[model samples]
Every structure is written in C-alpha cells, then in structure tokens.
Target: MASDVIVRFDNILALDNFSVSIPRGVVGLLGPNGAGKSTFIKTILGLVEPVSGDIDIVGLDPRKDVMSIRDRVGYMPEHDCLVDSMSGLEMVTYFGRLSGMTKEDSIPRSHEVLDFVGLGEERYRPTASYSTGMKQRVKLAQAIVHDPSILFLDEPTNGMDPLGREEMLELIGKIAASDKSILVSSHILQDMEKVCQYVIIIDNGRSVAQGTMASLLDQDMTKRRMTVRGSPKSLQTFSEQIHRDFEETSISEEFGQMNIVFINDGSFAMILDMAKGHDVQVRSYVPDRLTLEDVFIRSMKRDA
Candidate 1:
C-alpha cells in the first residue's frame, strides 16, 4: 500500500502525490511513454526512495527492509540486463545466488525455472547469440528462479514480431495463473487487456484511473458501436439526416457502419426510424463503453 507518495529525480518530480491501493492480482501499470512507470517500479523496489510519503510492500517497509524485499520480490526490467559471456543457466544461477541461495540450491532451481520459462534446451546456449524473445525469457527466468512472492515485469513485450509478442503474453498468462502476484508496466494497452485483472493508469507522473478492468470501462459514453448494413453513401446521407433531426453532433463511418454520437437528449429511436424508412439493415446498436485505450486517453487529458 502507498499513499500520497512523491518521488523526485533531482529538480524534477517523477511522481506527483501518487496515491493508489493496488490489490493482489495481475495488475498492469499503464501509462504513456515516460509517465513515471519505471520510476514507480524503482520506488517500490527501494532502488529510488520517495521524497515523501509512505510505502509498505506486503508486511515490510522498503526503507528498512530493502534486502528482505529484494529477496522476495522478482523484477524483470525492460532494458537488456544480460551478460554476453554467460550461458542462460549460469545467468539465472548467478541471480539466485545473489538472492541468498547457495550454489547447491541455485543450480537445480535455475534449471527448473529455465524450463518453466520455455528455455529448457537453450539454457546451455550463450545469451549473447539469443534472439530478443529468448533474451526476454532469460530475464524472466532469472527473476523467478528464486521463487519470489511477487513479480514486477517492466515492458515484457518491448521488441518482437506478432508471433513473438503472442508467445511472450502466453508465458505471462501462465505465470499469472500461479499463486504469485504480478505488476506489469507497459505502454502497450492490448497486452494488459489480455492478461491483467486490474489496471492503474498514470499520466504526467500522476495516478489517474485505477480499478478493475470491467469497472473502469463499464460506463457508456457519447458514442455507440453501431454495425449497419447499407451502401456507404446512404449511410452518410442518413447520418446527416439524423444530425439534422435529432441535433446529433457528427456521423463517422467505418467499414459498413457509422458512429452516431450525440447528447442524451438525442435518441436511438431516430436511428431506428431512419433505418426503417430507408429499408436498410441495422445489424447491431449497442452503447460504446470506453476501451482500455480510450480510458488512457481520458486519464491523460483529464486532470488527476
């Protein structure tokens, strides 16, 4: 739990009066580029101390129990942190030892975690020649080799093709299914939508929206995701007719449908009548709930 936390880097305030009660689950730390996500992770890990406010991870205070926190918390950083000369198994073992495990314990644990991360055979290969996805697996392997209680994954899908990204997300899903907790920080909202149960949206180095996925995006907005069947031109003209009749703001067309966003005073009854009069097909007319992407936009544009 963190309340009224402020983290500054020199003269700049990286996090501004941040307050959030993050529940234990697959939580995503969502933000735009340079929105203090990395800074927030560092503060939780005790790598960067906050200028003011309180932070308690599990039952321990980060300031006094840095090593204990490090021992139980796993971190997979976004940037490359691999040693070119070492093999994958050796890399994981080294991190395990650093987490207070003896060589005897680390050796087998490294193999088990590497296998769990889909790096079984390649554990003997040098990390220097590994692909981007493989390197990410190595990073993940090392982070969890010590069997930490919670994991922090920063930009788990940074660089990869479509297939690579899918595979990485699948691995993350498997991890999330386990008992261990996870906090993923990323600018990519799609991956977060796929795996996370909760989200904390940040902007301008401040917390904006934080809640469960369904709750945060549950409200219907000004737009409607209306799928219709008709000629493009007729849809356009009918849109104009609706605007003229019901004081609709605009009519935006995509594919075979149109977005009819209007004030609450406006009614979908007009749209139904228009469809009936024109003999056009109305496939579906449902309220448009904000997507995770849309919520991020709203959070950034609106003041915290």
Candidate 2:
C-alpha cells in the first residue's frame, strides 16, 4: 500500500501524489505508456526512492525493510532480464539462490516452477535458444521459484501468441486461486479483465480510478443497454414501438440484430411485451455491460 507517494527524476515527475490501497488478490495496474506504472513498481521494490510518502508491502516498509520485502516478493520484469548463456533451469535456480534459498531447496524448486510454467524438458536448453513464449515462461518460473507470497508480473504475456497468452492468463488465475497476492501490469486490457478482480487506472503519474472490476464497470447504472436478435421485419416493428414510447432511446441495427440503449427507468419487461405484441420471436436478448477497456478509456479521458 502507498500513500501520497511522490517520485521525481531531475525535475521530471514520475509519481505525482500517487496513492493506492491494493487489495489482496489479483489486481490489475493499468495506464498508458509514461503513466508511471513501472516507476510505481520500482518504488515499491525500493529501486526508486520517493521524495515523499509512505509505502508498505505486506506490512513492512520498503524503505526500512527492503531486504525482508524482497524475500517475500516475486517480480517478473517487463523487459527481458535473462542471461543468454544460462540454461532455463540454471537461470531459475540462480534466482532462487539469490532469493535466499539453499542449493538443496532451489534446485528442485526450480524444476517444479519451470514445470508449472510449462518449460518442462526445455528447462535444459539455454535461454538464448528459447522462443519468445518460452522465454516469457522461463521468466515467470524464476519469479516464483522461491514461492514468494506476493507477485508483481509486468507484461507477462508480452510477445505471446493467442494460445500462449491464454495459457499465461490461466497460470495467473491458478496463482490467484492459491491466495498469493498478485499485481499485474499489462497493456492488454482484455487479459486483465479475464484475471483481475480489482483494477487501478493511473495517468500522468496520478491515481485516476481504482475499484473492484464489477463496481468500476457498473458505475453508470442509469443507462441500460442490450442486444436483441430477431427477424428484420419483426425487429424493425419492435424498434418503432420502443422509439414511440422512449423517445430518448437509441437503436442500431445490423445483420438482423439490434443494439439498444435506453434510460434505466424504461423497463426491460415492457420491451419484451412489445416484442411479443409485434410477433417478434426474440432469438436473444442480453444485457450489454462496460468492459475493462471501456472503463480504462473513460478514466484516461476524464483524467485528461
């Protein structure tokens, strides 16, 4: 957790009164480039000293207890920080040892984590020989080799293909299920939506929005939107009826489907009744909700 955190570099501010109370779960850290997400992480890791503010990681102060914090935290950096000469197993084992694990413990633990990240036999190959996805997996393996209680994953799915990205997200979900607190930073909003229970959106080095995924997306409850599918003629008749009653309603049609948005006071039951009266066999009627991308864009615009 951080409060009133301020960090500057040679007159350029990186964190301007930035503050956030991250909950214990898989939380997404979202921002545009240069929004200070990486700087925030570094400050928490004690790699960047804030000019003013207090920061606590799991109860210990990063300023005074950085060593202790490192022992309990795992960090998968956004950029590649691999030693090309080292094999996957060797690289992970080295990080484990650095995390204070004994050789006896680090070796097997390295293999276990490597397997968890799907490196398996590839663990024997040099990291330079691995593909981008494999390299990303190996990076994750090293981060968790010591079994830290907290994880900071920066762009964990960078360079991964569709299947690979899905697999990475699944791994993150499993980790969250284990109760280990994770803070993930990714440009991919969809991936964050799939795994994050909470999200903090930042811009210009300031906290713009932070909340539970559902709460953030459902902030505007006054407007109701839904998609309806029916025959073209039936849909047109239904649309006309809705417009006649709810003058403020907006409807767009494409390929025998209609996307409708109206004031929440307009009842969905009434719409269904109109459909029935118009002899429209509603094939599908589903509520449309705001997505993480929608929330992120809105937050950035509001902050701007």
Candidate 3:
C-alpha cells in the first residue's frame, strides 16, 4: 500500500497508482525532472493530498496519523531550510524538541546524531559558515535526531563535489546498516546504482519499472553479450567469424568494439570459442541483460 499518495493538477497525474513495497536497506527513486519524483516524496510527507488512493505508513494513514508519522519518519528535504543564525547543534536539538524529546533528551541526542553524521566537533559552529557537505550533514543529523524507523532523503548529495558525494553516500550506507529502511530520490544514475538494492523508476508520472536489481536485469530473456576489442582489423575479423558461425545474431559496433547479441546459448559459446582461437582480446564482456535504466527506457518506449 502507498503511504502519502497524491494526484495533483488537473493536467498532470503526479502518481498513477504508484505503489511499491519498501523494505530495509536503500530503495532508489529514479526519474528525470518533472517525472513526478519530487511530487511523490511530497505526497508521502503529507505535504500534498491525493485525489484518489490511500497512503498508509506502518498501517496508519498519513493524513489521519500525520503527527505519529512525523515522529516515526525522518525526512531530509531537498531544499535548504536551515536558519543561518542557528548552529548545527542548536538546529538538531530544536528538531528533537519539536519531535517530543525533552531538553535533557534533545541536547545529548543532538550531539549523538551529529556525531553519527561525522560532524562531532563542528556541531557548535553556525551552519551559515559551513560548507555544502557540512550543511548536508547537519540536515541529515536533524532528520535522525529522534531515531525514526524510516528515512526519506531527496537529492541528499545535490551541490556536492565528487568527494563530498562519496562521503555522504557512505553515511547513507551506515544509516541503512542500522536496519532502517531508506527511500532516496536522485537523478544521478551512477550514484543511485551504488546504494539501492531495489529501484523504482518513474516517467511522465507513471512507474515505468520497480523491482530488485536482479529481477530487472532478468526481464530481457537473453543473458549474453560479446565485446571484441583490439585493432579494428582484428575486430572485423572476429565479427565475421561470429556472423558465419551463428544464424540468429545482431551486431552493433561502436568505438572499435563489437557488441554481438546471440539468441541461443550455442551461438554465444560459438562466438567465445572463435574469439579465443583468433587470439583477439575481449576488452569487455558482459551479458546483454536488462538494467534498471534499460527497463525504464524500454517501458517508456512501449507505452509511447
């Protein structure tokens, strides 16, 4: 069941029966801009109402149990909302208090959460002076101050350099390691591929694909890819041998490499055997299986 479901604007259906079962570890929401990724998160946060359907958070309706859900779910908003005057420590403590923790509980918990995000000593400094990474850390710390069961982070690594992005990714991994489920939205394909075990791809307000990585890859029905690399002459030589050996094969060549698609296992093995005999170095060999990106593209194309 979807929690925080929504359909906005008469012209646009933000979520069209968009439903997914989330479990522990990181679940990625991948889509291009205006693909309803942001709208989905906002709806789940109870920031927007759905025209139809229901959103249940751990069996409680987000609309009816907004307060309870707010306390149980931690969210790192996409935009910057931190007050410049407030120190990292003060900000986290403030959120903790707002979540129903007493002063005594909030203060110590703030430091712990900041430390967990790798901002221990810097927690006392004003966020105004912090770098983008540090501010992101503070935002993350505040979200987890109350130790929520689930965390929703939207573009957590936005505006970060490569190094900063890596560090933030590691911290997110740690959060997932603590046995809490995480739902993260990001447009960066490579980054999302690193953290999420399950992926949900949306396009034009519809869920194009949703499943585990392996399941998505298995959808293609064929699981074999050939890469012939070396001199262009050798590539051409090897490709001709493959074409002569297999009756049903499709070839796509690019950048001095040949991608051979074989429909049957016999043809796949035949190509490999021939390549070995010719002494051609296969630079890269991967199965032509589907990927999350592939499935996304294929599904969208099918619907179109």
Pull out the clashing pairs in model 3.
Answer: 3-55, 3-56
Best by TM-score: 1
Model 1: runs farther than 4 Å from truth? 221-223, 229-234, 241-267, 274-281
Candidate numbers sorted by TM-score from highest down? 1, 2, 3
Predictions in order: lDDT? 0.83, 0.89, 0.79
Off by over 4 Å in 3: 3-6, 221-223, 229-266, 269-292
* Model 3 residue 21 CA deviation in Å: 2.1
Every model: Cα RMSD to truth: 2.8, 3.6, 3.9
Give residue 176's error in model 3 in angstroms. Answer: 1.6
TM-score of each: 0.89, 0.86, 0.82
Compare candidates 1 and 2 on lDDT and give the better one: 2
Clashes of each: 0, 0, 2
lDDT of 2 by residue, 61-92 (tens): 98999999989899999998899999999999
Off by over 4 Å in 2: 226-252, 256-258, 262-286
Evaluated against the true structure, the overall lDDT of model 2 is 0.89
How does candidate 1 score on lDDT?
Answer: 0.83
